[model samples]
Target: MTQSTPSAQRRSNLKHRAILDAAAQAVAQQGYAAVTIEGVAALAGVGKQTIYRWWSSKAALLVEVYSDLVSRQALTPRSNGSLEQRLTGLLSALFRLYRSSSAGAILTGLIGEASRDEQVRAVLAEGLVVGRADIVTALVQAADASLNAQAVNEVVIAVVWQRLVLQPDSLDEAFAQHLAALALAAGRLS
Candidate 1:
């Protein structure tokens, strides 16, 4: 088989980027349930086969899209603030993202899909759950070396998931503070 030339590689990369961007835009605008491979292909000006070559299902594509969104948003905590302040800031940013953007809708839809699809469930766990838990664990450990990172991570994830699913409208600054405090308290207790 012949190797791909540099120009051909660049074209492929461009198409891949376009597909991802189009997927993100479609999900954000139309929501996950409404988005389709055909629609994303039309938006990206690529054939559906191109997306199929990269992702086997919509859930897989969405997992990558949400991961990209998190990376672009820079939701991690900064080092300058105190532990409480940093945690609060991080939670607040997440809340704002969930409230004002497509992240919330995308995540909600993914969670629902995860229940029925084993592949989606595994991908979501590895990409979303583990990644966010690692961030929270790092922040907790950085703040208090003796604290139980796992405990804090669990509390943070639980609170965030609960609010995102049950009381999304309540995910504001005040709730952020409450969650931060609860995480710290749980860490201390653990």
Candidate 2:
């Protein structure tokens, strides 16, 4: 009946991250459906109750893992490039993030599984919307033309993520740059 102390909490947090990483690796290799709480606990060398105590479901566990895995690098626009070039660089960074093997597969699977889980959908919506809005806000603040900012952001994010999640083969950095250039041109005209 002893209470856990602050150091024990920190250790528990570290164990939680290890569990999440192990879960991500398992999901990357075995796909989402095959990764159970027990499997992740076994992978992380922790107790199943430890996992359940922190995360209610595998989707919750994977979402944090996916976010951390994909977002370790900052996705800021380049300072030395033209608006189009900066946008292209941004797109390329995003392209690489989502297209990275573990993050990409886990994201796709999570989105699919999120269809059945409202909590996962909410988390996805919050993360994605904040990210997209942040990009658009940065563009506007960086003087990426005032008109049609929303449209421009939509086209860039859509093209990048569509290619990342759906058209993995036909899409490349070239295509993303081309799309960004077109969106920027159109935004300037508007």
The RMSD (Cα, Å) of candidate 1 is: 1.7
Candidate 1: list runs displaced more than 4 Å: none
Give me the candidate number with maximum lDDT.
Answer: 1
- Model 1 per-residue lDDT tens digits across residues 16-114: 889888988898899888999999999999999999999888887887877777778899897887898999999898888877667887888888788
Q: lDDT score, residue 151, model 1?
A: 92
Candidate 2 lDDT, 46-125, residue by residue in tens: 99999888777777777777767756757777878677788778777766765565777776776776678888787766
Model 1: weakest 10-residue lDDT segment is 97-106
Q: Judged by lDDT against the true structure, how good is candidate 1?
A: 0.86
User: For model 1, what is the error of residue 36's alpha carbon versus the real structure, in angstroms, after optimal superposition?
Assistant: 1.6
How high is the CA lDDT of each candidate model?
0.86, 0.74
